[model samples]
Target: MTLNSGCRAEGKTILVTGASAGIGYFVAEQLAAEGADVALGCRDAAKADLAIQAIRVRVPAARLRSVRLDLADLSSLPATVDALDVERLDAVVLNAGILLSGPERRVNAQGHELMFATNHLGHFALVAHLAPMLAAAAHSRVITVGSFAARSELLDLDDLQSARDYRPKRTYGRSKLAQMLFGFELDRRLRARGADTASIIAHPGGALDSLTPSRPPLFVRTTAQRLRGLPAGVVLHGKHAGAQSIVRAILDTESTGGQLWGPRVFGLRGRPRRETPHAHMTDLEAADRLWAASVALTGVDPLVRPATPLRK
Candidate 1:
């Protein structure tokens, strides 16, 4: 509850999941400072409160709210949507995800691979649940945060879930690939339906906490990370820098549905600009397969199910 006094986003409302920390937090904070009413979607109440408090400190009159969204639990997502008081959402940034701590593959309660579950499937369900709000808005955008790994040669559709074969880097990259596939297909579907919303993609180049001026305690510095601190300054950009692409993807007036924006310089460190996604991510057949798999697994369809009328 605050006044958006002279910012471009004065009357807009946006939902940023995984906004409790890291790049998500940076994006949410920036949006709030710019006068957008931001719904910080997070599972941890403490972190959420901290994030809100931090933004208020900066913006002084920032409008902010919270919604509990745990990507690991599909059951909690729809309820999360129901709790949002906003009648329409101008943007929804699907930014929350996990880089698994170990090489051993883990699974969520629904049994999807941990990275894929949290990053792709969870976001898949969330976007579907929020579609109504998006439709209600005069214009809306759905921006997904992707990674450089999405361009790697690690994607293997034969074992998309990585049940039989799992490599940490490859699995993470594939999940990003899945996200892009969904994003592209989503734009195609939304356009076919003549929807006013746009589905856009953006990725932070090589952003890490180490490069941040504030250097918040987001992660413990490994010995190797410490050794490269000097090089990190040149190679790594801060979270704030990373957030530029997300902000542009969400608010850039010139952008269109299915367009992608990323770092200008080889994806390591630079300003945000429109860029093409990898060939693997642009595959329509793969997008269709991933979309079907996501629907079957999450039990939430982004298409027909969202428009179905509720019954008492």
Candidate 2:
């Protein structure tokens, strides 16, 4: 599929969460190269600075800044976004996420599951707080970064927190699935109201840190690491390649809302292309349930309109 780049991001200000490392870092780097003002949304100021420095090294005049954002804490979102101090945002890449390693289920300060909190709820609230800034732009986009792992999982609305059953991979997949659902649902809501913003979902397919190129202090792939990952190159790609889906979602003017974009090869490792979301990911009823649950958990409704009451 030939991707269109008609919507150049030059002169636009974009906010990218989790921009401190991995795929997020590369997304910020690529956007900077395109002449867009890239704001690195990170929980750690120091790390964001390193990412900015790294990008500047590559793109000498890279326009970048750090915005304090911690997706783990719901209460911090409003203040975090307010700190941006920008009247308009051309796009927002909700790419920050955490994958728990141990078998135990982790929870954030607010007691919600850690992965679910950061991966889904945090982004949900962040979008709510930034709705006005997004609407302020003549045309804006909210690109939610999901995972290919979501294809195998289903959200248990009752067990969203994984309180009932918690296996590391399952929980992580469900969290990502919830995020994708919100992305699709947000698109529906935006279109239903004829809003200026568009919501799109993009997944990094199968990105391996070892396969990724070095970005210095933020990411360093030793020669050994690169060699170790060479074999997996047949089906996996580096974070830089993984970031293409996000870049396309943000800049492809022809790409409409609710479309899923990922790698072209078996949705794993290749150039970015439009892909079909799993059946469960497109269930409207489940999407609505997840939406209500998110609002109840975060107390922030996205795209609030007086005429249309919040969905229950």
Candidate 3:
């Protein structure tokens, strides 16, 4: 299950968004244990501090810092990048997302559907802004955390905002599909431009909180909850196991651009493995259309030219 045990990232710096809890938290913990300088990108300053403290409990020598990143507010992405202030980034894990549970559709500050905007547009913008930092590294990676849920959903590029028919779960799946399309398209553009950065997609199979190990303030599962979720846990898995795909994508030297990685057992549970993405996910035309729409909406074209060097 722990594929990266032999991998050492001593001199590398990686950023993980939504590290405050769940799969992101576990991914950061594993990376820190591998000696990577980890930047926890979170929306809440307080939660970020708690996650750092919790991670340090497990990794006393972890090199950890926090970046205030609110994906819902696209206007703040530039400032978030400025706050990072790192000369080069070894990798970035686009793991943060909003999983809407309510039937009612929500919208972010930009007036876009909440799930689509936060899960897709926000990450698209964030990566574009961080393109230079990624480019600065001799070799870098962008790990897009997608979902098995997206396998059954179709991305309506026309209704990206989900204005006409917005069911909660469907909207969330479509949003993730959009994000995956962007990740694949990004790799295509990077290769075309001869950039050194690689983009890979990773999806946590089926992660449940109750099956996840406790980290005190950040995440704690009640004994009753554990018992209740035991059946599903046996079949599915926890966030800890779920995070392995992302970790492998970042640390696995064999990993290449445009590859899809996920759990080994039917793409549902087990260790990390590279698998063929669903046919729909590989549609180049659909990916290209999503790319153009994303550029129009975010106003940032990544890898278009050499990035300005960051101040040390």
For all predicted structures, in order, the TM-scores are 0.90, 0.95, 0.95
In terms of lDDT, the poorest run of 10 residues in model 1 is: 212-221
Question: Scored by Cα lDDT, where does model 1 land?
Answer: 0.82
Model 1, 9: alpha-carbon shift in Å?
A: 0.9
Query: In model 1, what lDDT does residue 104 have?
Result: 89
Model 1 lDDT tens row, 1-312: 122233268789999999988899989988886778999999998888888887877788999999998988877776889888777999999999888758788988877788998899899988888888888887799998888878875456678889998888788888988888888889999999999989999898888766654422333456565556657767667778889888877776777889888877887777888897777777888888788878878877776555542211
Tell me the whole-model lDDT of each prediction, alpha carbons only. 0.82, 0.89, 0.88
Model 3 C-alpha lDDT per residue in residues 169-263, reported as the tens digit of each score: 99999999998888888898889988899999999999888788899878888999889889996679999999999999999888999999999
Error of 2 at 253 (Å): 1.2
Regions of model 3 farther than 4 Å from truth:
4-6, 305-312
Clashes of 3: 0
Candidates ranked by lDDT: 2, 3, 1
lDDT of 3 at 154: 86
lDDT (tens digit, per residue) of candidate 2 on 47-138: 99999889988999888999999999887777787789999999999999999899888888788999999999999988988888899997
